[model samples]
Target: MSSSWPYPRWIAHRGAGKFAPENTLAAFRLGAAHGYRMFECDAKLSADGVLFLMHDTTLERTTSGRGTGGDQPWHALSLLDAGSWHSRAYAGEPLASLGNLARYCLRNGYFLNIEIKPTPGLEAQTGTAVAHAAARLWEGAAVPPLLTSFQPEALEAAQAAQPQLPRGLLLDSLWKGWLETGLTLDCTALVCNHALWDSSSVLQAKSAGFRCLSYTVNDEWAVQRLLDLGTDGIITDRIDLFAPGS
Candidate 1:
């Protein structure tokens, strides 16, 4: 990392964390309302190659549709009630396309962290398309969305597609060769699982030239620990409990 991180210290996870339906425009709006200037969401490509916000490969958990979400074209995917599963308050909220999200963020001057959640074998394609779309969407802007993924191949493809956009390696574990992989991918940041970041791990990542970030950090103690370790960012689901910029 260049020690020149531009993102905020607090990021609202999946929009407003667990407060609203995750990865929806409604969630993002709620996140913004709670004073979050930066929001994180998942992005995947539909069958027709349209980029949209969705976290799972299958739609049963979060949307009204069944089977793989990527199996459907954008026209069909757009009609699903993505919010009904969450609660009646959010019933009938359509799945939001990346284009819709980009416009919303750009218009409001908010930052984004887009996790490229590709379907089972389309990692490279999704990464390439997302990078190209992000390049076009945030062109000439002061800051670009931080593209991140657990799949190194996807990040590599994204780098090959649009090297101008910053990339991060998401780690659920500090697996063997993790550091080398992040370096090879030209990552600007290393986003690790919350439980993995100790002082030693933070030092290791910082020494290798990468900003440290954690995900789904909710409790105040954990937040305090991360801050004490001097990490660059905290991705949290507690938008109500942990006010942004605090």
Candidate 2:
């Protein structure tokens, strides 16, 4: 048999995404119900160093709060209604911690892509905290998480904290020296905005021993394009629409 790639090619973005409050347990359940074996979520430290899930720095968009999420300790932040903003069906779902989500995924044998979304000016510290926490949480697992980040400092810190766990560098634009940066950071994958990939880009990355992944691809054309380029992973918000197993 061929070697087993630990991650699935299809990853559910922010759990089930628009179907539920992003970065909540409800979202993860929804994604799993839709047959996703792999999920992606943003992680950041609370004021007290608790690793919780929230995409934006502020809670205005995704939670029922008005200030910076990373500014509050878990005792306060954990109680905020992270779901009502999405829909009443999930009115009071609690903000989930990385440990909470980790238990669910580990028990069910699911894979994860943890994007290190640090608070402003805390990139390296946040990366170090999340990496250390993940290393502890996922101890003895068959496959570790694929840590990723757009911030170079965060990925660099993650590498320093836990070099054994694989990592990916997220990119929205193919900035100059991205290849060298990914190599320098020792990333196993390059996760990009879907439109960034083409024949040469994919070949260039693959030739350097890096897997190419794309994010938030919702349209059929985008999916087809990534498939054509032999992309390794496709992180999407359309878990309800995409057939994960197929």
Candidate 3:
């Protein structure tokens, strides 16, 4: 990461960190209410080629809809109650398209970090579509959303589709040559599980010019530790625990 990068320190996970329906517009609003100015979300294309927010391979976990999310067309996916599973108060929360989410973020002046959660065998297509959509949506905005993915093929597709957009590589472990892989993809940051990061890892990533962002961190001690290491950002589920002004 550059010494003068302009990203916020705190990022909300899957919208409001599981308080609201993950990946729904309702979650984004809830997160904003909790003073989160930036949010992380998963993006994938439905069978009909429309981009929507979802973190799982199947709809069984998060939606009232049936079947694998990747196998459903946009029309079917849109009709699913993406929020009811979380809470009845959010019963009608519709699946959010990338275009819709981008518009919301731009209008509200919120930053976004979109994780390309492509379905198996659709990695390249999903990445290209999401990146292309983001580029078009944020064409005139002050800042475009950041893109990241665990799949290198997806990141490559995204990069090829929209060279101007910034990207990050998401990792769960410190595999051999992880740094090299990140560099190969021209990623601006390395997004990893919080537990996988340590002082040495942070220093190595920073020294190699990659911003370090740890995910799902909710503890105050963890936050302080990352800050002490000069981490670029922390993505957390506990939005109320680390408000923007706090």
Q: Highest TM-score among the candidates is held by which one?
A: 1
Clash list (residue pairs), candidate 3? 1-209, 1-210, 1-211
Using Cα atoms with residue i matched to residue i, what is each candidate's TM-score against the true structure? Answer: 0.98, 0.97, 0.96
Find the 10 residues in a row with the least total lDDT in model 2.
1-10
Which model scores highest in lDDT?
1
Clashing pairs in 2: none
Q: List residue ranges in candidate 3 displaced over 4 A.
A: 1-4
* Higher-scoring candidate on lDDT, 1 or 3: 1
Error of 2 at 236 (Å): 0.7
Q: Which lDDT value does model 2 have at 86? A: 86
lDDT of 1: 0.94
- Per-residue lDDT tens digits of candidate 3, residues 187-223? 8899999888888998899888899999889999998
Per-candidate clash tally: 2, 0, 3
Off by over 4 Å in 2: 1-4
lDDT order, best first, reads 1, 2, 3
Across 1-246, the per-residue lDDT of candidate 1 in tens digits comes to 466788888999999898888999999999999999999999999999999999999999999999999999999999999888889999999999999999999999999999999998999999999999999999999999999999998999999999979999999999999999999999999999989999899999999999999998999999999999989899999999988883
